[model samples]
Target chain A: MDEFSFIDSIKPDSYRQSSLIKGIDDDAAVFRQNTQDIVTAVDTMVDGIHFSRETMEPYSIGYRALAANLSDLAAMGAEPAFFMVSIVIPSDWAEQELQEVYRGMASLGDGYRMDMIGGDTVSGKEFAISITVFGYVERNKARYRTAALPGDILFVTGTLGDSRAGLECINKKIDNEYLIQRHCQPSPRITFAEQLSSFNRVALNDVSDGIASEGSEIAEASCVDLHIAYDSIPYHSSIAELFPNQYQEWILSGGEDFELLGTISEREWPEVQQKAEELNLSVTKIGYVSEARESKGLVYLTMDGRTERLEKSGYTHLQEGRD
Target chain B: MDEFSFIDSIKPDSYRQSSLIKGIDDDAAVFRQNTQDIVTAVDTMVDGIHFSRETMEPYSIGYRALAANLSDLAAMGAEPAFFMVSIVIPSDWAEQELQEVYRGMASLGDGYRMDMIGGDTVSGKEFAISITVFGYVERNKARYRTAALPGDILFVTGTLGDSRAGLECINKKIDNEYLIQRHCQPSPRITFAEQLSSFNRVALNDVSDGIASEGSEIAEASCVDLHIAYDSIPYHSSIAELFPNQYQEWILSGGEDFELLGTISEREWPEVQQKAEELNLSVTKIGYVSEARESKGLVYLTMDGRTERLEKSGYTHLQEGRD
Candidate 1:
């Protein structure tokens, strides 16, 4: 079939939102969401660079691609409403495999009522998927990394290093279903981020890259120093037992965690924990923001009454810096 | 540099619109435009599948990629506003060459005041660029292919087949600067489309995949038959002079024209011509819509008082169909 025919075969028959006046039929998709500000995030995942067939199933590949974009919106405290996907297919891929990819996305998006409005499908040598997600946040209420202030308590949602460890487990052929599932299915901290918007100001960043990279970003953007207590950062017990020497490396610098890392005021820290508890989420306070000293926007790891710069250790694609 | 640093290096230092609350610094770009309905179009161009270094310059590739998406929004009569880009860079490409790509997009977008809001940059094996554009149209005023009715006058803006001929010239190592320029630089009929949107109802489509595919799309969507006069279809004089035998084929099936095709009320035909004259746009009355007679939504080409079905003649990626 032609590109148009394939698009016709895959386009959603009916959209859930009346606001989505146009979907895939027209030259462009049309929609209006008037109640709040609009937030958009676009992410691209390639076959070799982002995932490999040996390690990632088609469904998990699709799921994680959308999940990464969703995590970005979650960090901004945006409620995702609509998404568009642009996928490049290789000739070897079957039509059924493509449907599995869509099914994977629907499994996640249907829960949030997010509609797949429009996208482009084309044949290429390598398989790649690019997803652009749109969401709404309250007017002028979208959280930013610059919102952190001195005396704010730094916190993270869920355990860190799970995704990186999970990826290692998959590569090593280790029999750890929990770790494998963690690598494949990352849950964006949307609920916690939504509640975070109620606070006066909370600097939020998602842990796609390791905490070292993410914490450094927040510090640089807010022009404040972050003092992370090394012993306080949480991780899965299995990761420590299985890879004791490398567990600290993964906890500090392993990427693709998809957890929320934010700095909130000391006064509101208790309330934030209570809300996380109410939602049955694991919220851990690992650090605090402080006025920049000695150097601007630096992150320090404090353990055993000794302080040292937290070095970025994750793999970087084009150069020697953590993601 | 790493992905984040590369993004920081290329992101716009300042934005023209206050509606853009956030740009590249955040996880997602946040913006609010309350005046009109939003229109979004996304297009992806790959190195080997869409174009190659042998036939296309990096700048033209970038320019044409954005142009195609802008043309989509134009077909819907949406005023272009902002766009985000997701690009995959191969190891061979230099940073300067990448900047040229951005320069190509900026050359067109700056004229329309469209801002580069946000996107992701990643490393991959092959070079690819996907652009997602956002525009605004008057509430419920956007045009669609389904709006055509019987007795509506069909029109097309600008000459067709130049791009296809240009591609042939490049492949054959022919030095025809005019055709090559026409192939590389396609001016979207945004001004004409904006004017057309003032009418009550007009069915519209962009001549991206040639008139055979585009006209058929409008016909099928509107559930009407289109009678196109073969003699009235406009083409560059050079095409007929240079390749007399294949000119008709190119005119009918040559894709990437980036011109607007629409059907409007017969009463508004004269006014449309007048507006075209005012705007210095070449608008041709080549056909009219009719009730579906023998076959629903079929397109017939008439020449010498004889009519024939217009078959799709362009190349398909995975199967046999145009575009």
Candidate 2:
């Protein structure tokens, strides 16, 4: 089918929102939000680099592409409003495959109450999808990675290492449904971010490049030192049971968990924890921010109680060959 | 270089605006505009399909990718604010080549006072750049292609067929600087759009997919028939001087001129023409919107004064194989 026909077939009428002035069938999409601040992010996923067609379904690819961008907005304590997707598919791909991709995106978009407003569909030598998410936050309420104070307590929402473990499960042909699902469709911690931002959290970031990398980023951005306790870092229960030996490595260095990692003041820690409990979320206090000393930035207390510098290494696409 | 290092090295310190709350080094970029309405557009350009690496520079590729999206915003009569780029580059490309791409985008971004806010860079089998531009238009002042009425005069900003002629020059090794530059870096009609929109255009569209296709689009959207005069259609001077035989074909069916095409009521035509002249822009009256009858939408008059139905065939990516 042609481009227009394909777009028309998948166009969702339910995407209309009061804020949207215009949607598809125009040169550009128009919208309005009352909030004074807007959070925007763009992410691209390549077939071989981000996922493999052999392992992932087309729907999962589409879902994960938007999930990655939504995760960025979540980290910024922004409520997702809408997103645009630009997809370049291989010439050989069938119309059904493209439809499935949109279906997957619609499913996730519906859950987030965000619309797929506008985008471009083109032909390329390989399959790639680029998603741009727009979200809103009140002025001065949008969280940043540059506000963690020396006395801030660090916390993370949801378990880590599951996505990495899921990848391992797929590679090893392990029959771990949860692990594979986690890898294929990791959820963005939007609600957790909303709850934490309501309490005016300090620094915020999503654990996309492993806890180690994210911790260092917060430390560098806020001009502070981070002290993480290895035992306090929450690992997926499946990881501990299925691959106990790799739990620490996966929890500290594994990526694509899409969990919110942030810092809060000591005074607000109790209330933040209570709020997380109210939200029925698994929020864990795993570290503390301190003034930069001789060995500035990320330092970790090992399981054996020895302090060591945490390496700023994780899922750097240029180095690791994947997102 | 790793992803972090590459991102840090090219990170523009000058991108910071008073409206930009946060930029790179965070999970997402944050910004706010005082305008009540926001306009967004996205376009993706593939390396081989959109422009071959042998014929185009990396910088031109980057510039054109963003330019395409900006053109869409221009068609909406929006003021350019910021844009994000998601790039997938082959692993074999040199770091300098990648830097050149950013430099190209930075050049255009600086011209429009638009920030390169945030995006993702990943490895792909081939090079592709997807750009999402965010702009703002005053509420009720934004232009649309669906608002034209019967007896509205069609006017296009700037000369047409230059970009296509430029492409032909490059393909045939014609060594025409004007044609080549027009093809490589066609300017988006933002200034013209800003001027004409002040006069309240009835309908608007960018001439991306040839005059015939765009004219048909505006006609169909507005539910009116467009009667275009063949002699009034503007062609670039270079096309007339260098390739006179192909001038008609290029003006009628060529794509990627990035010029604004729109309709204005006959009552507003004089004021619109004055505004275009004040802006030093070329605005030509080429057609008029008529009430839809049996053969509704688009029709054209030949040079000999004979009428014919205008075909909707232009640059459909699925049929043409690329943008």
User: For each candidate, what is the lDDT?
Assistant: 0.86, 0.83
Give the range where candidate 1 chain A is weakest over 10 consecutive residues by summed lDDT.
A314-323
Model 2: per-residue Cα lDDT at residue A241: 91
Fnat of all models, as shown: 0.70, 0.88
Q: After superposition, how far is residue B234 of candidate 1 from its true place, in Å?
A: 0.7
**Model 2: residues >4 Å from true position, as ranges?**
A294-296, A315-323, B294-296, B299-303, B315-323
- What are the chain A TM-scores for all the models, listed individually? 0.94, 0.93
To one decimal, what is the Cα RMSD in angstroms of model 1 from the true structure?
3.4
Model 1 residue pairs with clashes: none
TM-score of each: 0.95, 0.94
Instruction: Show the colliding residue pairs in model 2.
Output: none
DockQ versus reference, model 2: 0.77
Interface RMSD list for the candidates: 0.9, 1.1
Writing each residue's lDDT as its tens digit, candidate 1 over B1-323 gives: 46555666678878876678898887889989787899998999888877886678878988888999999999999999899999988888877778788888988988898889988788888788999999999999999999999999999998988988888888888888998888887888888889877798989999988998899889888899998998999999988887777777788878889998899999999999998999998999999999988656878788666677775554232122221
Candidate 1 shows a clash count of 0
lDDT of 1 at A77: 94
CAPRI verdict (incorrect, acceptable, medium, high) for model 1: medium
